[model samples]
Target: MIRLDTGAITEIALLAAHCDDLAIGLGGTLLTLADSVPGLRVRALILTGAGTEREGEERAALESFCPGADLDVRVLDLPDGRTPVHWERAKEAVGELRRGGDPQVVFAPQRDDAHQDHRLLAELAPTEFRDHLILGYEILKWENDTPRPSLFHPLSEVVARRKAELLMKHYPSQRDHDWFDEESFLGLCRLRGVQCRARYAEAFLVEKATITFGGA
Candidate 1:
């Protein structure tokens, strides 16, 4: 398989319906980019979990994942499991985020995600970031919602373990959840790793992509 570089990108935007979603979905990717790209700018907007311990955990987790990078995060106060009910506010928030800056890539939840919150954000990402690469990420949960992703960002074994470590260390509030453990995180990464022939990888689904093929 050929490794495709995103080319000299300096900014990226991330959208998640909840905290920990980004960490669970693309922490390794963040870790990789932050380490390789000097002064990378990462902007994140999460629809829920504001004013709670989850928000604090999210800030810390992202900071840990994206060392040596410019990181900004905003968490909105919205009801969990009811993103569809607050469609207008959610859409507006996404729009506002778009107005803030133009990122080369946008990471959001997958449309086919079994969770409504995840699915809603996934659907909304393309509407707002039309000109960018919208990488829809998967979150593992009790529901059989794991997607057959077309994109795989390979992670080194160490980075994959570091992602698991950071997830467990930062989000203690999610510790009780049955699916929120290092083993499960590594398990999924391992599966994706087999597919990509790497020790580990994070998978994503691409709803749409634009490519240019000519060299001047």
Candidate 2:
């Protein structure tokens, strides 16, 4: 288990457009948080993939990634590639998730991502989670080709391997694609890890945060 020596963050929500997006973007970080903070709850709100095989894959993947934690896997029925077409419904779905509780940290794709669905989700996050810290995960798409991510969450080698295993085990839809292989996951983590002097890491772009120099 990867132990992070830190205080517990109240909650964390991983918002993504697809099943593998959460795993590909912040799997390692999720692992670290769950292992280190017993109070931590990881909720994944997949904006798309509602009535598809991908949604099943996402459910299984989240269970494996966050064991013994509060895990809520929701698939908003909004059509893929048409989130903009149903903006109100999408916003209502997200707002419903943000109703009972608020997370200390929220993760979503960058607004500049190549995918229109991702961009729309990022834009919608702030509207519901205005009081929380928001971090945008970079999707390796054309628009985010040169993402200068400002935050790095280091991952141990073992956790990195677990991430790869979960990816392959849960998401079989992208197995044929070479880019979704274990090698690619490790490569990206290693590249980001270099910035933080760790064997592996996940990069994130921070939108806003409340910082205290010493004491809160």
Candidate 3:
């Protein structure tokens, strides 16, 4: 596989349908990026779980994931699992995020996600950030919605373990869920690592990417 380097990503936009989505999908990658690029600007938008314990969990979780970076998080009050009904609000939220700044890359839910809220945010992301590279992160759930990802970000053993640990520690609300555990999270990362010849990794679906053949 030919690797393409996204040089010096100073800003990143993170979009999610609910709390814990970003951490579950791209926690390791966020850790790696923040370490590599000091003062990286992270603007995160979550569609649901505002004014609840989940919101606090999300803030703490993202701060842990993007250490030393300028992280700005906004958790909205949209109804969970009802994104389609609040389509206009979702679009407006995305638009407001787009107006803030231009980011080199965006991490969002994939179009094929089984969750209605996730799918709606995925569809709306591209409409606002038309020219940016949008990597669709996968959230492993019981719905069997994982897609064959086109992009891979290899994670070190340290980052992988830390990600699992942070998830368990910060998100108490998710503990009761049957699928929330270190084994499941690490197992998924290990599987992706196997796909990309690494110890552990996070995978993303890229709908399109521009490749420049010649030197600048």
Candidate 4:
């Protein structure tokens, strides 16, 4: 596989429909990126779980994942699983984030996600951040919705293990879910790693990106 890197990612935008979505999907990638980029700026927006325990959980989880980075998170109070009903508000929130900063890369759910809320935010992401590279992260769930990702971010064993540990540590509220266990999280990472010839990896679907063939 030919490896390509985004030269200098000083700023990133993360969008999620639910609280633990980002951690479940891209925690390892965040860990790897945060370690490489000094003073990285992370702007995150979640559609639901504001003014609740879930919101607090998200803030703590993100801070743990992106250690030492400038992390700014906003959790909206829009009803979970009913994002389509609040379409206007969701769009506005995305727009506000776009105006707040121009990130070199954006992480969001894919359009083909089985969950309605994820799909809605995925649809709206490109509408606001049209000129940016957007990577669609996947959430493992009971539904048969795992995407065949076009891009893979390989992870070190330590980073992969740390991602799982942080998820279990920071999100106590999600521990009851059958799929939230360490086995499930690590299993997915290991499988993706096999696909990309690594011990562990986080895969993403790239909807749009610009590749420069040679030096300027």
> Residue 63 deviation, candidate 4, in Å?
0.8
User: What is candidate 2's lDDT per residue for 36-107, written digit by digit as tens?
Assistant: 777577777888888899888888888887776788888877787888898888888778778856788889
Q: What is the C-alpha lDDT of each candidate?
A: 0.92, 0.81, 0.94, 0.94
lDDT of 1 at 216: 17
TM-score of every candidate: 0.97, 0.92, 0.98, 0.98
Instruction: Supply candidate 4's per-residue lDDT for 121.
Output: 89
**Which is the better candidate, 2 or 3, if ranked by lDDT?**
3
Ranked by TM-score, the better of candidates 1 and 4 is 4
Candidate 4 Cα errors over 4 Å, as ranges: none
TM-score of 2: 0.92
- How far is each candidate from the true structure, as Cα RMSD in Å? 1.1, 3.0, 0.7, 0.7
Tens-digit lDDT string for candidate 3 (1-216): 557777778999999999999999999999999999999999999999999999999999999999999999999999898979999999999999999999999999999999999999899999999999999999988899889998999999999999999999999999999999999999999999999999899999995678777754
* Per-candidate clash tally: 0, 0, 0, 0
